[model samples]
Target: MKTIYVTAIFIFMAVTVFAQGGPPATPIDGGLSFLLAAGGAYGAKKLMDRRKNK
Candidate 1:
């Protein structure tokens, strides 16, 4: 039981230290591309649903 508690505490501290290293920056171009892709998917789904109902 004591061993398990120590292991858990060590793991938690390691994760906390690693997480403090901030993530890389995101690209603005990628955001625009993602938005376009999502919009296209939504439009295609709507078209498909409209056709199915007809």
Candidate 2:
């Protein structure tokens, strides 16, 4: 409970800092690469979860 809240707050702060000009501009991809990477990561996580439950 308390640990979850602390982790959430820390992650929010980290993402906030990252969104504030942390990475260089991607002219060609136009942020599609980020979305693709996130999707792939999410899919991998789901697969891992299913495997773990089985």
Best by TM-score: 1
lDDT string, candidate 1, 15-34, tens digits: 99987957788779988999
> Residue 42 CA error for candidate 1 (Å)?
0.2
Residue 38, model 2, lDDT? 96
Clashing pairs in 2: none
Give me the candidate number with maximum lDDT.
1
Candidate 1 displacement at residue 12 in angstroms: 52
For model 1, the local distance difference test gives: 0.95
lDDT, candidates in the order shown: 0.95, 0.91
Tell how far residue 14 is off in model 1, in angstroms. Answer: 45
